[model samples]
Target: MIEQFFPELKRYAEDFVASYGYTAIFLISFTESIIQPIPPYPFIVSAPFFKLNVYMAGIVALLGNLLGALAAYYSASFLGETFVKRLLGEKLYLKGESLFNKYGFFAVLIGEPYKLVCWLSGIFKMPPLVFLIASFIARSIRIGAFVFFGNFLEKFIS
Candidate 1:
């Protein structure tokens, strides 16, 4: 099928990750952290397969994801509770608020390492400094995971 008509497509996928690697990684991390639908960790993991391309992929993922988190945070902060309640529905708004209070930025710490959690932490009105610190800690953990699992990740698939 694909290979028969365009055998090079497969090879392209490999180079594609390397060639446009930074842009794609950043887009996935940053956008997904906001209202977009991509996940962050997978891209970082996917990048290591190319070996030389891996470090750049990881960096792109981190910056993009952090940018996405900032977007989510600002969106939530400026939107206000009343607006959030109207958009998210009272039930979710209440739950989010509770979670925000219960975990503080640490809650985001758990999820932000992935992407969406970073923004959600911001939205819940967690302290800015806390969010920043927690995000950094979580991201560091995630980055470390990438490095530790680099070899294994080459063949990772879901």
Candidate 2:
């Protein structure tokens, strides 16, 4: 489905990962976490196909994702609750608020994909160091899985 809609993007991701190596993975990971719709999974998964070192790729990607997440976190922090409330509206914002209030740190760690969790964490003013730690752990696991699957796919094909 993605290929059908965005063949050029797919090709660009492939070519970028192939040519730029870990740097590509880092940049993609960063962009994806911040605002880009394309996830970094494809880049991580295709690293082996490009004959790039999967471990390095994963680490660099993790770093990028952390940086991006931090950017999101800080951006939301700067924007404050009024902006988020206006953006999300009353009902949705309340739901997010309820979840974050209940789950706290785990909300950010577990719901990394939601992206809103990161923003909400900042909006609610979760401690910066705590947010960083939880985000790092979550992103590490996620990136590891993508790298593992990429290597697994490579070996399967070979």
Candidate 3:
């Protein structure tokens, strides 16, 4: 359904990323981790249009995102569930706690259900080394896919 919006979406993505360059990559990744509802796709897709190397763009996205994720995780862990309950209200925060308790690794995949799992892993206090490994896998998959499609994918598929 949303595929129909590609013309407008592509313009917005390309323009924003092109205008902001690498800084946009940092902001998108950073905000996605904590404050906002954005996913990392737009940043990744926009890289090619800006003449930025996709590999470096992906790495910038990863570093910024990881920092934001780790920060959010520590915030949640340090503040404790009680504070989260009070702030977000008991119902919503408890759902978050339950998600962490039950399907921890899988929950990592849901926030953006793609690359943005980095922040959730941090929020859940997944081990640093483990989180790093998980991030490597997730971000690698995203960057690989982004580059593949943006580069040779159309020819291969066609």
Candidate 4:
């Protein structure tokens, strides 16, 4: 688990959400989509604990992820494959490239290691419109599920 290696990161996320609310959600989600190792789920889950609106947090997170994905896409496009491969590492870059080659645009929908998919989409020159649409749909479903689970857990605990 991430905590085993980066305990401070977990506390920092919690503290960030507690201190900054929706802004924290957006930043956390955005960073996760781009490069942050920590996922946004736990931050979203902690929303209610901070008296934040879970549904609104989900929407904010979704928007942040969309923007971050776009940024990643564009970065890979302009920066070239070699730069991206180095940033993402050879193994991950190769794996993402493989998935994109195998699945085409649908790889964005697959959403495994989501950042890699975004980077690969750009590196491979996927149609921008298709990438955006697929990312929106996939991220909506993914964030919605996390919000639903977070809400359920909040209620269960309360």
**Runs with alpha carbons beyond 4 Å of true place in candidate 4:** none
Query: Candidate 3 lDDT, tens digit per residue, 1-158?
Result: 33365566545645667788778777777766665555566556545656776667777887777777666666666776565556566665566667767976656644453323543454457787766565556666766687555555334433
Candidate 1 regions off by >4 Å? 1-19, 48-52, 111-116, 152-158
TM-score per candidate: 0.71, 0.84, 0.68, 0.93
**Candidate 2: how large is its RMSD?**
2.4
* Residues 1-158 of candidate 2: C-alpha lDDT, one tens digit per residue: 66888889878887888888888888888877766666777777877788876777888988898888888788888988888787667887798889888999898788745467777888889999998898888888888998899878878877
Cα lDDT of candidate 2 equals 0.81
Better of 2 and 4 by lDDT: 4
Higher-TM-score candidate of 3 and 4 = 4
Best by TM-score: 4
Q: Scored by Cα lDDT, where does model 3 land? A: 0.62
Question: 55-122 in candidate 4: lDDT tens per residue?
Answer: 88899999999999999889889999899988989988887777888988789998578888888899
Which pairs, if any, clash in model 2? none
Q: On residues 1-158, what C-alpha lDDT tens digit does candidate 1 reach at each position?
A: 44476557445544555677677667756776675544545556666544445666667777776777787778767876566567667776576667767877657776522434554565666677778787777876786587456546665631
Structure candidate 1, residue pairs in collision: 30-64
Worst 10 residues of 4 by lDDT: 39-48
